[model samples]
Target: MQRNQIIRTRLGWTLLDGVERLVSALWPARFKGSVGRVLLLPAVLLIGILVIGLGYMIEYSFHELDLSTYRLKDEYSLVNYAVIADRPVYMRVLNRTLLAALIVSVTTVFLAFPYAYMLVRTRSALTRKFLLIALFLPFFIGQVVRAYGWLIILGKQGLINSLLEGLGLPTLNLIYNYPSVIFGLIQYMLPFAILLIVPAVAAISEDVELASEGLGANWISTFRYIVLPLARPGLIGAFVVVFTLTLTDFAMPEILGGGTTDFIASAIYDSFFQLSNAGLGAALSMILVMIGSVIVAAIFYLAGTGTLGVREQSR
Candidate 1:
C-alpha cells in the first residue's frame, strides 16, 4: 500500500511539474489578460481582412456594370443602388428572405425548447446518449445533402409519392414551393437551436426548481417565473444566429425553390453568375450586409448585447 501510494504521489508531482514547465514556455501566468490578447492576434488580423474586403465591395457597388466589357465602369455612380431601389423584384426577394428567417427562427425555438429541456432534465444515461446521438448525427451530414434528402422525400415521384402510388393515392405537390422551403429550413435549423439552448437549460438548478415547487409553485409557474427568464439570453442568441443563417442561405432556396421562389441569396447569385453583373451583385451584397447588421444590432439593442457574448459594454 505504501509503495502504491508513493508511486501515485510521484506521478502527481511529475504531471504538475510538466504542466508548470509547459505554461512557463507558452505564456506567463502573471500576465494572463495580455497573453490572451496575444493569442487572439490572428483573429484580429482576420477581421481586418474582412473589413478591407467589405470596403472594396462598397467601392464597387457605387459603379455601373459595363455589359459589353463585363467589367465595372471607371466612373462612380449609384446606378446599381438605383436599380435595386427601383426594381420590385429585389425588394420582394429581400422581404421573402427576412420573413422566412423569422419563421424558421421562431419554429425552431418552439420545437427545440421541449427537446432541449428533456435532454438536460433527463437523469438516465441511456437517454442522454440517445439524445446526444440525435443532436449530433446531423452535423456529420452536409447541409446540401440534407436539403437533397428532402428532395428525395418530397419530390413528385419520390418516397412519399411512391408510397402513395402503392396505396392508389394521388401524389401531392410537395417540393418547389414556399412551404417546402420553410419546412426544409426548420429541419436544418432545429439541431442548432437545440445545441444553443441546451447549455442554458442545463444551467438552471434542479434544487431551485424543487424549492419553487415546495413554495406552492406549480410546474408551469416555476418554469414561467424562474426558468424562462434565465433562458431568454440563449434563446435570443439562437434566434439571431438562425435568422442570419436562413437570411443568407443559398442552397435550400436554390435547390428547392424550383426556379420561381428566389431568396436574396439566389438573387445575388443570379446577379453575379447568371448575368455576369459583378457590380449589381456587389450592391446586393452590401444591402444584405446592411440588413443582417440591422437585425443583429436590433437583437443586441433589445437584449442588452450580452446575448452574443460581446464585451463592447466593457469599453
Candidate 2:
C-alpha cells in the first residue's frame, strides 16, 4: 500500500508540471511581456478618473459664481483667479501654508535621520524591534484620532496641564495656535520621513564606513562625507513627501489652529462649503495643485528624481 501511494504522488506531481508547461506554451508570446502592464491597469484607470475630475474643476474655475442664485455664470472668465490675486487674504493663506510646509519638512527630516540610521545600523535585535514598533505604531491609528489625542495631551485641562498643576506649577495653555499646529504636523510626518530614509540607510554598505574609518577618518567625518552623500536620495525623498503632505494638510490646521491660523486648504474649504462659491473654490484648488506641482517639479529638477533607488549609470 505504501509503495502504491508513493507512485501515485509522483505521478500527480509529474502531471501537474506537464499541465503548467502546456498552459505556458498556449499563452501567446506577445502577451507574456505585458503581464506587469496588465497588473497596472487598475492604477491607470484611477489616474484617468482623477484627470476627468480635474477637467471639471478647471471648467468651473473659469466661470464666476452668482451669489444671488448661487449658480455659476455661463460666461467664462478669469474672475475667480483675479479675486485670488487681488485679495491679500488669499496670498497670506498661501504664504502661511508654504512657510509651514517648509518648517515641517525640514524639521521632520532632521529628526527622522538619526532614528532611521539607528534603526538600520543598530546591532541589538531588541533595539531594532523597539524602533520598528515605535515607528509603525502610529500608522495603526488614524490621523484624525492622533490629532484628537494631541488635543487630549495639550489642551488647557489636559494631561500636561494636569501634571503641572499637581506639581505646584502654573498650568500652561498649549493648544490652538500656529506653533501647536506645526508641532502636530511634525509628529504626524516623522514616521513617514523615517520610513523613507530607512531603505536608503540600509542600502549603504558597512564596508564603505569601515574603509573610511580605516583611512584615519573619524566616525563623524565618515558619516558626513560618506554616509550622508549616499543617503541623499532618501533624505530628498522624505523632504519632498513631508513638504507636500504638510502643505495640503487640512485637519491639523483646522483642529489645532483654532480657526485663527488657516492654511490654503482651509481657505478652499471655506469657499466651497461656507460661502457656497464652487467657482472660487475650484480656482483655489487649482492654484494649490499648481503650487504643489511647481515645487515638486523644482525638487526633481535639482535632485534628479533618484529617490526610488535608481542610480545614474556611470561612464
If scored against the real structure, what TM-score would every candidate get? 0.89, 0.92
The window of 10 residues in a row where model 1 has the poorest summed lDDT is: 306-315
What TM value does model 2 have?
0.92
Q: Which parts of model 2 have CA positions greater than 4 angstroms off? A: 1-26, 312-315
lDDT of 2 at 129: 99
lDDT by residue for model 2 (1-315), tens: 999999999999999999988978987677889889989999999999999999999999999998788899999999999999999999999999999999999999999999999999999999999999999999999888998999999999999999999999999979888999999999999999999999899989999899999999999999999999889999999999999999999999998888989999999999999999999999999999999999999998888867656777322
Residue 137, candidate 2: Cα error in Å is 0.4
Angstrom error at residue 315, model 1: 23
Model 1, range 135-221, lDDT digits (tens) per residue?
Answer: 999999998999899999989889999999999998899999999999999999999999999887877788989999999999999
lDDT of 2: 0.94
